[model samples]
Target chain A: MERRAVFKSRWLPYALIAPQVLLVFTFFYWPTGAALVWAFTLEQPWGGGSAFVGFDNFAAVFGDPLYWASVGRSVFFAASATTLAMGVALLLALFTDRQLSGYRAYRFVTIWPYAVAAPAAGLAFRFIFASEAGILAFLNQISPGLWNPSMNGNQAMLTIVVCYSWKYVSYNFIFLLAGLQAIPRALVEAGAMDGAGVLRRMRDIQLPLLQPTFFFLLVINLTESFVDSFGIVDIMTGGGPAKATNLMVYKIYFDGFKGLDYSGAAAQSIVLMVLVMALTFVQFRFIERRVHYR
Target chain B: MLYRERMGRAARIALLAACGLVGTVAADAQTRTKFDLWQGLSGDLGERVNDVCKRFNESQTEFEIVCTSQGSYDAAVQNAIAAYRAKKQPTIVQVFDAGTLDLMLSGAFVPARQLMEENGYKVDWANYFPGISNYYATSKGVLLSFPFNSSTAMFYWNKDAFAKIGETAAPKTWEDVEVAAKKMKAAGMECPLAIDFDTWQWMEQFHAIHNLPIATRDNGYSGLDAELTINKTKFVDFVKYLKRAHVEGWAKIKTRATGATLGEAFASGDCQMTQFSIAGHGTIVKTSKPGMNWDVAMMPVYAGTERHNSLVGGASLWVLQGKSKDEYRGAAAFLAFIAKPESEEYWSTVTGYIPVTKTGFAAMQAKGFYDKPTYKGRELAIQSLTASEVGPLTRGVRLGGFLQIRKEVTDALEAIFSDKMTVEQGLAQAVERSNATLRRFEKTYAGKTLP
Candidate 1:
């Protein structure tokens, strides 16, 4: 039975929640409202004044083919990064949950990469995968012109997807591991006594029970990969040898900050936010039905 | 209620003390009239800027110039714009060449001529080389900003490598460059010419030197609604030639994409010849291998065409408006001090930037400054800048969204080099994209015209 606490003083409860409400309003709602206004107006770069353009900025943004290309690239990046991140994290979580020897150290090591900031990780990966004078340089000696990410677009995409997945894998592993541990140990032992192998037990007992955690990670990773891959893309590809890696978030930054197109970038932000919100809504409405919860 | 009253009294006492401290600081600020200058470069160049401020500070007691580096040119301008919006902008800022139009259109600064003349300084505006001044001046021939850290493209060749390939002098034309590259390759030089595909070096500078138009309306100096002309120029031929060079393996790509810059590739002797700014002279000297012999010359022109002056690539100083009288005086004084021939020589000597005025170049020559091995070959930059009269097409690009245009050109180059798009297709596509950007900029400032 769930117990609910009743407040004797109605005003006291409102006061207790006021700070949180104020923070959300100030940080999230205020900036979002400002972005909405900016999206419909033409902003002067030097702040002389802005004019009300009324959907003109959005019209311009949607009219550009390059903007649409960025949307496609961002979708590809998010899907690839999320699927790769969750698969790797689930694998590692499964390994650690088996209570193998030195599992504590392995768990600690797995979680360590999550603490690294995104850009720093991107820079480290950039040097490590550098074609000419990096750890991968030996591949060039073995097969000349084989490991050139700077020239090739597919290789460039793979590089960022790998880097972003590496960073997020640790985050997913922690959650998945906790969820794995929450399952009663007797459930697994029970499946094993029914003439089932380890993989069989994992498929029937562990996999079905872990669906809730998997669904939660899926929604979080997909939404975050849309926006949070900016640092990785900025450091590694910088939107490309041919705009191959120009994700929507990085494009927004480049146009607004470097190109000084404020209204156009604001329109891009609105599109990105709407896209992410729709994605989350779809995942909850359809994908959540398949997720089994106790 | 008694405790709260006691706490309020204590807080009021602290606030009074804070106000008193602020008053003293404000009084000190008034006495010195310290003004801010936001420069766009850092490291060794930043230290040189700091040294200039220190020298100026020591020369006077009435005003102090506080110089700060905002990392890169993009950051400096972006931060300055933000600061302007907040009414906290600096007195002076260093803006790069591409930003000239945006600043010129924004009406945000006091013209250098007006500022200098108002401060009782007789600036010989004509003495500023036409090639340098034309880039910063208005259509009415009014100078908009003070030229600072000026540089132009020059061809840097490895002397010893050229000698091994039986070349006695640096290449003066593209055919000569190709001949030298072929000879070097035969002589076991793997990467004969290192190319970075920098927009300023390849697209803009190439167009300027070839006396070709990059955009209509005299490269956008005539109007805000100017369109691009890069597709209808000799640039298409240059791209075809570059593509051929890449296919033949004589021109090796050297940029951050390849994990080595053109300057680094030259310094390490991985490439025999490079085309970059004269400002790279100092760093190349320091980083080159011991006993490595190198010299620089003016960039090559096509065999049939007359070579025009190459556009200056570095930044210029703009005196931002809306500062106090004392602050403006301090800024004018600092500008005057830096404009003297000796100060120009000192700046050029340390930083490898060419002196902006003819007098500074003459002063350096009279003193045999270029005869020194450390400073040799840098004179070619000045020669290249003054190679011909500043033609309408060669003055400089003044279009808004020029930085994006440069990026578009770079993307075109990459696509061409990768064989994903033909040279003609890429150039034409880039011109289309650039025109779109221009149209958007035209809409942003609908009623404004070029000053």
Candidate 2:
């Protein structure tokens, strides 16, 4: 049987969703449309008028070596942050799924980090990892200059990655926990009747069953790592000791806001939007086939 | 009951109308034109800016000035640009030194001289310090902005630390700085000479003191096609020197995250010496521990060249266009009042910035303003900026996109200091990148020439 909530007046449905449609059109589609226009034109630095220089801005962005380097760095940042966040989240979810003491408290504590803003989390991590007057400062006291993130590129990158992962872990944990709880005890019991151990049962049954949740978390985490690493990179290292943590998003902000190159920044953002869209597309097309919905 | 309610409502309406009439009449009686001033200063600096506006408002009945502090220098300039585009900019904006070129080229500003003259005020344009005036002047030598708080780079060192190291005098040259830094290091100073993240102390001060050009076309004062000449100059040698100091543990680079202001380190006796803006003197005097002896000296020049004057580092006030005539008059009155010797003395004495005009300097000296213990070494800033006659290059640097260029230079120096690249390669790459940005800026302006 087919069932639906049919409205007597067509205007009722429209009126009900008017606010959402208005918000999406005003905020998202409007800005996206403006960025597209700017991406194709060369804007005057100060306001007067802009010229239509189709594809020139994009060409300039693509030809820059610094842009290419930042793209490569963004991929590394996203991949590492996603993997670390999701891996730790999965481990915590699996452990908390068991009958443990203060399970409610543990779940609450695990999800608390996601509530903190990214820049605040980055600032907190910065103090902890600072070369002077921080925990790392104490570590450096034992071995002089051991953890100077200010001067060391690798250490700077590590600081940004750790800060970003710390924020995303809570988000991944919630979905993973729900997925773990949704798995039936009968499936594990059946595996046990087949003389399988706890680890073996989890490997064959629970792991396969949790694929959809894992896939969803992976996509969300990867997209987040790509677009939202700006605040972390900005507060932690400012894309330095020497552009060490110059993620694409930070580059876009630095070039646009600080550098005041509007057209170039717009062009770079256009590229970023397309890149993210394509990445999401590829994930759904290839990886979705393996995800078990039930 | 209905009749009583209606009567009460009518009485309330009559009272409201009477209050509105009185409010309008009172406002009309004052007949004061309101002017908006947008500045980039907060905290102590913001207080000083507000104090000036308050004083001006109190001194007059015809006009009122309202000042708004927009947090940081960069924020002020960026916001002003956005506001100007939206045709909602204030009458006056305080733009920092690095943003001078961008503001000059924006074409949305009425030159300060023109504004004042049009409003029937006569200002002694030549009374301003040449080093300060030249930075904010047109190519034809006309003043374009009112220099409010001007400062120059100088060296500050701890007197107690020097005494402990058995050195009585401040370092006068780079070689002397190196020797003093080594002695401080040997004397158990952890950060012997602290380096701030600001590249101006290293690049602009060094180049100006050594009488070297930082860019072609008279350091971009002549035209828009000025390419950076830093790579060709002795700036590389200076970078190499700084890098060597860092590697040998005599110098520590202080970033904001690292809590690197020299004032703190000097107060704690960790850093023996530092090079920073003379305006930082006020901060040190205010924040440093009691009885922490310190003095300012001229920035260290190179070994061979005689020291030239250093360029100014503080901000200036510009009159933006597209404002009402009444607002312009109010702004002009405020500027004229601020240019007086009394106003200048109050500002310079409270802040560490030097008075921009000769008359202001004279007035402050006559009143023994610098005779106080807290004002010690404050005069070194004036001396440093006016050490010699202002030359073309020493006048100031004016280049489009200089803020970004400065970041590039700082990044390069950081890379070199961190051993990620050699000094030669880093400087060369910085010059190349800066030139590219300059070319883009030139293209943006197109057929028009930079004034």
DockQ of each: 0.52, 0.43
- iRMS of each prediction: 1.4, 1.8
B85-192 in candidate 1: lDDT tens per residue? 788999999999977777787888999988988888998999999899989999766789999899998899999998898778999999999999988888889899
Q: For residues A93-153, what per-residue lDDT tens digits would candidate 1 score against the true structure?
A: 9999999999999999999898988877887888777777678889999998898778788
Among these predictions, the greatest DockQ belongs to: 1
Which pairs of residues clash in candidate 2, taking residues 3 or more apart in a chain or in different chains?
none
Residue B228 in model 1: lDDT = 93
Candidate 2 deviant stretches above 4 angstroms: A1-18, A96-99, A178-209, B1-32, B257-259
lDDT of 2 by residue, B327-429 (tens): 9999999999999999998898778888999999989888888898888678888888889999988988988778778878888887888888898998888
